[model samples]
Target: MTTTPAAPVATDDVRLSAREAAERHLRALVGRDDARLREDQWAAIEALAVDHRRALVVQRTGWGKSAVYFVATKLLREAGAGPTVIVSPLLALMRNQIAAAERAGIRAVTINSTNIDQWQPIHDQIHAGEVDVLLVSPERLNNPGFRDEVLPRLAATCGLLVVDEAHCISDWGHDFRPDYRRLRTLLAELPSGIPVLATTATANARVTDDVAEQLGVHADGTSDAAVLVQRGTLDRESLRLGVVQMKTPEQRLAWLADHLAEQPGSGIVYCLTVAATQEVAGYLRDRGLEVAAYSGQTEADERHALEQALVDGRVKALIATSALGMGFDASLGFVINLGAPASPVAYYQQVGRAGRGTDEATVVLLPQIEDRDIWAYFASLGFPREEQVRETLAALAESDRALSTATLETRVELGRNRLESMLKVLDVDGAVQRVQGGWVATGRPWSYDAERYARVAEAREREQQAMLGYLRTTECRMRYLREQLDDPEATDCGRCDNCGGLTISASVSEAAVAEAGQRLSRPGVVLEPRRMWPTALSNLGLDLKGKISAGAEPGRTVARLTDLGHGQALRALFREDTPDGPVPPGLAQAVMDVMKDWSPEWTSRPDVIVVVESATRPTLVRDLADGLSRVMQVPVVGTWAIRDASVPPRAGQSNSAQRVAAVRRRGGLDADVPAGATVLLVDDQVATGWTLTVAATAIRAAGASAVLPLALAAQG
Candidate 1:
């Protein structure tokens, strides 16, 4: 949507000083006659509008970072400059910014993943000077067509460049993004005299300096005049920071159910995982709270609707992951984290969402022991090893044509998400180029930068340690966080728990605890069978292609390994130090519950049970099959053995193609199958589902009419 055009610059307005004009614009933007620009905000706006200087603003959230750019855009456009180009990070932020721009009578339009059809028209408007501000995602910066075509003209003509969440440009930032690093190329292409503004509330001193350096580089690869770095105190006086130590996931849920209604207004309840969001939101809703789950997995339309719901007070809270971290604007009364973030800087950013437009808001952290495990899981998705990177580059170099990510997956052992992330970094480093079809090697020399990656990893570990320290800290929470961000003006915030300005009850009602316990302990997760084989399996010496002719029927698992309830138990049972043994009685009962819940959907019970040999937990797999066989009154059949014991375990394989190839290479089903008999296949756990799929294909090939796959836990 476009904003209202600016009112004509009157003869009298033309004579007004820049500061006076900025104050007038601020009054219009805030829709208050008395509204005035804060000194820092005005300074930032003037730097860009009057001085044509690059600036980085690292003030706290809700500090009017958007106002600096929008006001500057108005001043620039009114003086015959082209529209400002804002490389925003999220659609929610774009929506908020567009509305804010409209308030200032600055026309704004956006091009993001949500509006592919409108991109051309939006670009047309941009070129025609009909749009006063253009907001695009950082990913769009490297689009084949946009980067090769539209960006040059935009860079040459754009009056101002704005990078929201500028911390993402540095690897040291808590929310580092490889796509943001592409801004270096964009900055290099811009003509001289164009002003740039990078804004983020989450950056620490290191990130601030790195972003400033990146912002100051000239088109000639030389450092230009120092960038104007405007950082302010990060303390939020309106926030009442506190921490409630939770011994169990159930207690955390109960605490939320017990006190959510007491919170002043609708806010956010942040979880570390998408599964947790659904779990927590469901439990809260069942307890009569109006809440919904939000994450990257949520559809675009639903995310928008849920955001509006929270804004309109339709929902008490939106249980979410980091997907809701940036650009979500609500005068939230509380923000509760069910688990702690790995970094205090990231934690500060999420908590910043609260108390933005309110006089006072509650910010609480309910730290769990499992948070470290969750942190480790996320850290594992970072840049792949040097060997994996080299393999990816070699694959691209040898290919005659550009290889799609799916195709490349068969050639290298990196998951799709990690592979795509690496490709973006490579593209930014000039070692690869993304064209119309996919990605191709540019034949540019590239180094792995092992030392740099090690430093990043070390920094991450230190941040994680600091987060743990936050959990144990007895000092003022706000002051501790501000100090972590290197805020020179940090002082004890008397509004936190330690300072006695706020007191939160740690007790949860017995009834709520019992109900929460029941919800978390509930078992059973649907395991949808794989229908299609991975593409280009031949690259890995596999003969598979297209849809599988012999696939297992839909099955059931006791629970996802990531589930807050059974997940915790499963994690304990499957720890690396945990000894292999027969299935525990409790877990066996849960498996039975899963079966009972799933029985209604099955056409018939299986005739026989078979076990997929587990190299890691052979005894556990066999015992699970034997127990199921006795319970279901189905005879225990022969085992499906791994043909070659020396073959490497499937755990080491990263991508789907590699896992499939590894499973197929070890021959399947060793025993004869009764023709037309249904077979029950049991495994300890299912991560990629490839092993089960390959084994089921073998069972079906042995003339079984149907194969039913069962696993104790499914990886989320």
Candidate 2:
């Protein structure tokens, strides 16, 4: 039978003082009789528990920021207050916090995206006053049901509110999040004298002031004088930092293969992209080292198991992207960056994961020349243009009912991810509302903050330059990073390479380098055929919907442009300044090899070759098609031409609906195809696959039995 848990009883030790009670809770939390709170930790706890005031604590990792809140929760509950609500940022962090609360004898529960089924039961427990502490994600703050139903009551009844990773709350911070801005509304709803705590290890002077200002404001938009700011020096005594520069990516991989095991205990190897994580992990595994790849693409269950594996020292390192940045706690003995982060602030956050539980942790960076390109790609995804925002608002204003993101895709020119992000910002800004089905206009006046966005963009550019400065600086590495974070006590650490403490070897075995090069050079990526047409295509005057009737066969690409192997070559060949000509001999050779490997998987041989007309690189596309036809002994059939030669093809079209419409309006097969013949459809590159799909469909209508698509590169 199901039963609700009973509410926690207050501590019976009334004779003990508040400090004594906090000490007792601390000892219980750390499972050590000798455990005691630091001075700043006690100050933070006192501000919340004794003074009933808002506080922001900025301390280094492993400085016991969590102990203050957990201890404060114990004291507050003992004084007959309600449960403490913690707005945490990451799932991994939530799990760790819940476990820590359990250690302190506090009954904690969580509600996040991964636990939808348990939200109601958890809410029941909260209503029953059985939960002493409740953890929630920042995204949950604006959830329609929770915001309308649960949040108001939780705000009124909650005794304490904690915002962990508070750096994300400020736009000036390296990891700015739009959802976190909703905390202002929550704060405005909070009753006076309800103690609140904000904590982060990575807030600079600017971010610190921003967060403190937010915390000090009350329900009536008035500032309180009693807000406490407890900030400590940012330093890690256990970290020994160094930089190892290599001439090429292959040398870096080779060096890792040669020296990864020589580092301290289990750790992480950070990569700039998901593709790099996979490639690095595979290479390291092939070299007889136990490793696994972790990214946003990794499954939740698999990610949990991988975390466990790392904590248990089963894997030497987790080759990962920024997805593993926050809230993952382990006694990591080392951290190696395969490429530099865009800013020193972000770099400091990632490296903070290490040296938290142990002394003498090794930190290294292998700076790459390609880091700037990766940074630029991410920078492009920032806030949209003023015109785009206006277009979105106009569309919502014209709609009678709430429109889903898919429906908006037909009317707006933004991609799905970018569009959803903009709507969230709009919702938080009071210009729109996210309801049961979708979003609706709130009719509230909203203006584009052009100057603010421009400032943000300029700040990002400065941060990028600062990261580049870190690479070339000859000063103390640790101190350099600390200064970038605006640490007042930034000083030289005696353990970095510049300080003459340690020197990393730049040597790699020639054989290992050769092997690494060969592994990266071997390339063939399978492209799955598009099975279904994009939704609401009919709205664009295209008579297409549901599953495509005659789609192109599953195809092959020589490599993804994101690949570490053939990517460099393909990027050079596709540059705007590079003159269009015959395909490079080296790339042509690689394409032939890809065909050789893919031939065994084919259901039938191709009898004719058809090339997709390219306005940008026509010479390269035609030369590739003719070379393939001559080598494979297939007849050159015809060209797939753009029906309108006067109109230039649009570049950087955002969504699939727009891309499909554009392709169908201009795509046509200009050559005759033999009936019941297999046709090879070739293109220079495949981004959305709409052009190839349209061309293949046209060929099928022209009496071809089957169409096999091929591309030189795939854009991920």
Candidate 3:
């Protein structure tokens, strides 16, 4: 019903040609995709593509960082670029990204640990310009063959390099990986001037600087030019951050269960150690709750299963270490920390894991007082002394040539594992050159001086102390993050342990038993050992002065006796008057009781009766009297390794040992026992009864009158 309309005449007055008109029309045909049309997101996309070719997006966790890359990748595909290459550290992320891209009808594939062995096909596709995107890992890029094979081909196509969790390039980040260093080398192999877009939830000034320098964008190291898109405040009105200091591990777990019972929302329970992770998960599982555990040692298949279970809600709570949080996207309503996180960066990362897909989430940290001391020990992380360094360096210098770390360490008396860390430190300092099996000393002294080492150790100690200080940080945790990001207008985000319901009590001076403290340095009258025995007497039963004559002249005096089974400390221990001089008063009774109890009705032979104080916790014998008093009724004694327990955990052992001998009669357990005697041994728990069984054996061996185990809890 229509007639062809005459073609409109072009104003070709020495101007608009038909081709120019067609170009104009094609240019206008490029319409904005609705997928990225959100006002803020579109602004970000346009700013990225047209305004800033290289950008750093500091978005919160699960703010759709992948979406940003998706829009970019699609635009590039539309422009007929050869292909896009994405360098992703997490294999799960690569898979998810590939799926998302495919769902969006964009051709994309992954090349990483899972498929590096069969990378030939993927490489071929890249060479053929068949791939729309290739996801990679830093480790894969580290391979010379892989880089040479794929980078050049894709570099010619000139798409883009998207880096996920790029903060790892900085040492300040929690999960820094050395393989990330090789990324620049891969970039060099790729087409010149390709864009690099890196994203992370937590990168501070130091991290941003490191990323820029490592990527070569910070040539001349312009720290200010580092691209960062600051995301505004997120909605977390429902989150409640709470922290609790517990006295024991079991108590912490029990408290956690009770808290979970109150809410019972989707959550993740993070454990500091792998053993704890499994045990906690097991406890939950035993309580008829679903649980999946993740640790560094977990198998790849198991990790994948657990992660999927987390996403699917098949598992109510996933007990994991920090390793499980990478690239995991779960709008988990709650995240719980079983102990103090090793670093503030870790704390932020773990807490950020919650409230991903939802507006409301909660984070809880159960800080046990016992763990405070443990973490404080790590906070004072020790590096070997310069003497240790010198010893190690001397060993390295003397090494025949080209030795591995393991081999080099064996040559030193400082110990192999402990000695090697210093060597690596020297290597890092550029004082030594490592080639193959051994290190060739640079002959350039690492300024080998004690002061320099001291400074370096101090710097490390300060950094750790800073992390420890976070435990007592009064501000909300999110505000802490803002401070780390170097923002000027920061506020206490009001969803942290301090801002929530945690109320701190003012320190009150104690009036009762203030003088009962175990401080040995308080000004006091000269405190001397009891005159009942010599001050120099050992903890074990022994006569430091003269051999205790078993049949000494009878008198009510602190007399020593030989073969009474009393330890050297018995020489100093108080003695009760006996018919035969003064015998270690209660010691003889304990030995006799152990002998009789071990071998029902057996009279005990004289055995060492040392009064060791109650050693409820494992500690040094000298620093604090631990495990000093024991019932001599047991045949065998418990010995402590002479190694100094007082030394910091990181420092090597002091090489000390303490022995506990059995309190038993020379006669077997079947021997007759004297009437009207009493003995008791205390334990926290009697699990499996093996400890009691062995105690009976020791009592019989020590010639104890009897052995009776009185534990708080005994299993039938």
Candidate 4:
């Protein structure tokens, strides 16, 4: 069958053709007659074709950011100035590059503490200006003896310097490294105007900016264009995002066994803990589901072998962590997020691993309600505090022996990246020793535990505020999320708690569709004046007395977050049990009375409307929506929409507020809606009711003869 090629997508950004990129690399590696290249490798090659003196390659993990630099190194190498130097983060990646080079008949070498002996010749060749390229880690560069010897020797003849996994430059990076900052100076010491190329497949816009800024590059030359450099959206159109709501880990395991037996594909099941990873992998393997486990604790060779097994069909399913996805390709059909993914970034990166090289794929996000509070507490910690770094440094200096990050977590209360950052900074100062296997302190002492602990805790509080802001912002969740990551399609999950809690899910009947409208309910969870259950109950008794309803919303209950709740309450409310948890004493009555007696601005249809403003990271919104839905389960209409009021609109209408009002004339609004579907207005609550009145009217004129409004609250 003859097929027509798709029209080039008309994006403002320039895209590189794989053929052009490969041809350029082939010419550069002219002497290597056996260089085999894939389309992805060529695309990366073209992306690395730099006009600017310094370049950064941020492609998808498997999109070959290394090849881009490797090919560029090949070009720069044959130019015959001096040997090129590569600073990589991992020993495994360096080994991968060396192996590929050897296979291609080109010379390459790596220098990490584990393989320091093999690097002796590489150091001599670099000093003598005879080697083609040398790869080393940043920790090695900061070595006092190596600083006086290997780096200075190579800097004299080095033509190009490449730093791989450049996202580590970001303070927000999953793996931040302070050692990276010092490498910026090595180029200035080099003679040939050694242009640096930093590369990664994972940096978001913020990380990208940090990387360029840290490298001291103006970054104006870096295209503002987003290449489809990250893995393609793997929410496969052909694969359904199946969901299994479970209470305990065991139930999930049982569910997986049965489900895979019914519809199996080379698959992956992810767990947040190493113990869980082993448990799941072992359990599945024992149960006769070909399985393997991958975690940070797994040996590099073992992890790589598991990845290969997934691809080669040696294992039909692998239970692993984020370690499996960064740069492996598996033509698998399924992935299951066995727990609430930590963040949208982490989730995207992990789920992206599935469906690669396949025509289609599927992902299942299995949720545990118990995970919510932990996630909330987690989101509360957004960024690492400077004080935390300072404190960590002091502790490391004081300690005589080296310690692993995991060990410090127990000895100290450090957030994930906070611990990684301090260790990275210590490595830069040469005050810490990165042993053959782990990290340890080198100096006599700096500061003890108490003072540093307070500083880090205080800093964490500040970061928690920022993370709370992201979760609670009163703007279009899509635009808000984009502002955070500068990427597209983040707000797509239809099942997030946020999406489920939307006005549509709670709005009143179709008969009252024209009367109600949607809005954001404020001061949620911890950040605002939270309407706690006990407090509301006590207050209602003290204040409203007879106004509250005793028995209502049949077979429904809610667990509300007060300004504060002890672990005992949290566990009782969230831990899987009997369906939905109970709201703090009187809060349930408050929500019920509010939904039943509270009037939405408009009227005609359903009793409530649920509107999930954002879907990117749906945990918060979904929780509110689902909670409200369960309470007002009596057939409410749900509306899925995004409200980005911040981006100034076209012509006179500057934002969503005025534009949505103007929409009253057209089919109500522009994106897309069923022509005759009724419009039931929804919002978290109505303070003055202006937003509801406006939204309801607009949707009414759009089609619905009536509009109904509903919310979590209503004012006097």
Candidate 5:
């Protein structure tokens, strides 16, 4: 896909003066009668309205990036151009932009996943010229129906095309989306005189160049036009940054509980994972703080409510994951990170949400030792393997009919989300197409581009390393982050802790730490049983599909290995380099406590204790089972032994299908427990729970009435 620019139309050659119109639009947008357009904002509007040339604006967050587009849209519409089409990335962003447009008296509408019911009506409005701006998600550009039908119409008549959060168009950007790559097609198809504008607040120099190139700006005269690049300093003078190194997650939680109320106003607390967000928010709420957990698992309506609550200062903060990172709008008074993000670029973007309109905002980072482990977990889910891609292509080529994602799952081993992500990347590469009901092979030549993917992966590792350096750096902390983004004019801000010596206190009260320890140490997380079998198990020679014939009983784990409190200890105990031994005395004691405190929902008391025999860590499994048996005063039953010692281990199983196949073939029931007896089943660590499920199924079939699984730690 090529994104060459159209020829530049000089300002003098333009027929209209957009400066006065832009100022009028800005006043309405900010609700100030005397509001004036900033010079950069007016320049961008003039380029789009008068000069009809593509422009990329890279500025700091809260620097009126939205104004450039809104004013440009108003001026273009008044000139009788087609409605402006904006390719926005996030739902929150769309909501904020639409509201901003309404303030400026521009008729704006959005087409996203939430409002499919109104898509046709919105389409009608666009065609009837009743809308001034139409905002669409980047993912919509690849929808077969939308691309084939609506996109052509949009391209033919669009007044101007705006790519919001344009950094996502470049792989070098901290947050890259495969869907944004399809903007090349949209850009190439646009009419000759229709202008384009790409806006972002977090891009560094490298990302700027990549985005500019994608828009057809090249060093040699290869493009149809030249791209006008406008970049500004990224320094956020209102943000006072600091890092507090906490030896333990408990200390971090204790600090927050003791000090969150001291913060100036409502803000955000970012956690690296969904589980962490829930745990942190729960702990804060227990301390009588007004806060809520927000993550990808949060329902749409609940997310909206939480966003509103934070905006209205009803809650102290929203403990959130990166799901709440971008497009969230609030002049938040502070931003705190439970642990560092994988990269400084991402870190800046998350914290940038704070102090947008305030005189000062506190930005603190509480670095944890387990951050690397969390980073590794997410890194494992990157681009699919070339073999997997080939398999997907071959599978699609085998049939003439289109296949939905669910149906395709039968033939591919990838999880549903991963499969969809791969398909999208392939679609942009022209190897596949999303049809009405599903997907079809385009039969176009496609290469895996191994070198490029490998390079990107290597870049991610470098970013992770840079984040560690940022935590330890003594030079200005804000400058460290800015330098990572390739900000050329980066300088010491003299505001961060490194520049201004420990602004946030490192000490936490003993009472708070004790309370935090008690809360975190109260173990046992409910382990829900796997309800449905992985789809298309039959394709893998297993006669399993839909719901399982007999699902395993809900089980309990002492704690998630990723839990902030027990996580560090549990992780060290389970490290690959750690020598295997019988269960540690302390962990064993914790296990007993977990059993003693098991909730009433775990109604079935075990009469017999059975263990899933382990080949890799036999001593650990046996010792744990023996300890549990002694505590429960139950007879130790036989084991669910491995059928073949040579069977591959399930240690690194990444997806469900491979995990199911591995566990089913390697282990089986050997216990002879009495009928109608509840069995206490024990295992070392449960990652996907397939081993536990397989063992439980066998035990039940072998005469046990029920199985209650117990594990040392659960790996989420």
Candidate 6:
């Protein structure tokens, strides 16, 4: 059952001490009559309300960080200060805070991506003194309309400002969100004497120092060295840690199937990738366990439902990616990682989700060898090369009017997602700004800090090495993690598997192993065709723009070489140094299995096979095409040849606009085709799918009735 707050106190009572008022507020917030404020909590509240000074609190999870802010909001509101303005990082965090505030009779409202329709109402509430607290996602601060219309008023009158998860303000934090850096601009614009509070649970000394420095600087660029800092122990006695090293994906899956039922209560099973989350969730359900998959791809409404399910114990677990991390408030009984995150700090943050409100909870790491490769893939997606940054700045500078991200994508070589990430970072760095329609070049002097970025990259490498060391360490697991966070008083915890010996059995029944093996070895994934050409492609001098005609049906990839089952084999075949060779017997066989398991959505087989010409992997592409042709007994049509051999392969490019241009410039399918004949277009791999799209479009326009795109393996 949920907690209910105590009755509201009479705000007009002159005799209520700050301490008395704070205790009352806490009682109301937690629905406890005897709730007492911790000494540090009281100190933070006094600093914000009485002294009106900035403070930083680095406390562990379930540490009542919210109470400090919520109680302070109530006290400040009763004193006739404007509503507290909170800069939060996640929607789940905002939702939890809003609920907690309601219990305390605090009228809290939020404005974020999922509530655009309610933003005006929320603004009115704040303006009319109806809101005791206002919460907003950091990304909202960068929205052109929000920044121009709402921020100035709030900054000028907000009684208190709270930066939750303040560690994100530092690039060194476990998760570096570029949008959070924009908080500096917000801080600079805040009215003088407004109390500011920054709270985080995951920062090491280095990150804390950086965040403190950023928080100390005021609007006029004056630095105050007197900012208060509160540091606390990260040690959680309720957490029992363990590591189960598994040799293969199947072994891990089999182990989970056999052991998950023995876990204490409903909890979270964290996966490193969205695909893995979905895969694990599916396998678990097949094993008759109630579970759900949650990721960024899940709709906002669905994510909320899944979160509620976990909280209410409706499901055994929510198989999730980092999207479900950070702001989730359930007192989960366990947290199991299928693949270890690259950093020990990040690992600590995720595992911290467990044992928060319970006496003890399981925290296990099922580390797999594939995790390193996965980490390397993601780490490579960080800040673009200097040339890409310059190209983006130049494109925006040339535009007189603001250019939308789609239009900018046409002008730059970066993919839309990568391009957007770069622009947001640049926006915070003051090199550019997102304005009314899209983005504009700020024309501010900006230098590419190659040194800083390199340092960050190096830091990431060190973190990865530390995590690997964590797997092998026989010392206290909790101590190893605390030391990674640079905890000053790190010590051995008698709770982990290392300290007490393995409490979890690593054994799995052979039948379970066989089932897991079958599940992992499964191949084939549907490739949903691009519905619309990227926005503003015409501006880049490319005639191709707008919706992709529907005749080029969605295709199939034999496997996402990233899959837990067949991924290892596929990775070996696609390795950089591996010579271009003919399709191997094993991979060729996997393709046959994929054909057998083709989705019902793809109802037709090809009448003619078409190969996408490859300059670098010609032998591999042709051999795969020939192999497929022999298997399906389909006629081999002429290949799509490159118009110019001098154009570089589109292997390294990350953006869709450039990939399309490169593929189109090399124009394929020169000859006309028979009408009404189905064509199976093949490629060695599909990264961005532009190559497949361009080839398929050429085939369809050349009078083929239908086109089915096929590839040996799809890039993860």
Q: Which rank order by lDDT, best down to worst?
A: 1, 2, 6, 5, 3, 4
TM-score of each: 0.97, 0.96, 0.59, 0.52, 0.95, 0.96
Q: Determine the C-alpha RMSD for candidate 1 after optimal superposition of all C-alphas.
A: 4.2
- Give lDDT tens digits, candidate 6, residues 1-716: 22112223335343248779999989999998989998989989988876677899998899999999999888888888998999988889999999999999999999988888998888887888899989999888898888888999999999999999998898888798888988999888887778899998899999999999888787676775667899989898899999998898888999889999888898999998888988999999999999999998999999999999999999999999989888789988999999999999999999989987899899989998789899999998888899989989998899899998877777777777788888999998889999888899999998999999999999999999999999999999999999998888889999899998448899998988998988887788898787777766677688876788744787888778678887778888888888999988877888888877773555566788888888878899999988888878987778888887777887325777777777777757854467878888888888888887777888888888778888888888
The reply for model 4, stretches above 4 Å from the true place, is 1-52, 125-131, 179-182, 185-192, 217-244, 261-267, 329-333, 370-423, 426-484, 488-716
lDDT of 4 by residue, 281-367 (tens): 655665577777888888866866776677777887777766665445456777777775545555555665666556556666666
Error of 6 at 59 (Å): 0.6
Candidate 6: Cα lDDT at 64:
92
Which 10 consecutive residues of model 1 have the lowest summed lDDT?
1-10
Residue pairs that clash (backbone atoms under 3 angstroms), model 6: 414-655, 415-655
How well is each residue in 228-322 modelled by candidate 3, as lDDT tens digits?
45454442445566666654444555555545544435778887666567656766665567777888788877888887887877777888887
Q: Which residue runs of candidate 1 sit more than 4 Å off their true CA positions?
A: 1-16
Best TM-score among the predictions, by candidate number: 1
- lDDT on C-alpha atoms for all candidate structures: 0.89, 0.89, 0.51, 0.51, 0.85, 0.86
Worst 10 residues of 3 by lDDT: 520-529
Clash tally, candidates in order: 0, 0, 79, 69, 5, 2
lDDT of 1 by residue, 543-596 (tens): 889999888999888888778999988988888899999999889999988888
Q: Model 5, residue 227: what's the lDDT?
A: 75
lDDT of 2 by residue, 1-716 (tens): 22222223325353248889899999999999998888778888877887788899999988888899999999999999999999998888988899999998999999999989999999999999999999999899888999999999999999999999999988889998888988988987898778899999998888999999888776665777667888899989999889999998799999999999998999999999998999999999999999999999999889989988998999999999999978888899999999999999999999998998897898999988778878988898888899889988998899999988887888887888889888989998899988988899999999999999899899999999999888889999899999988898999999989998878899999988998999888978888888888888877888888998886898999888777889878877887899999999889999999999988887789999999999999999999999999999998888888887665575326788888877877768887799988899999999888888888888989988888999999876
Estimate the Cα RMSD of every predicted model relative to the unseen true structure.
Answer: 4.2, 4.8, 16.3, 22.4, 2.4, 5.0
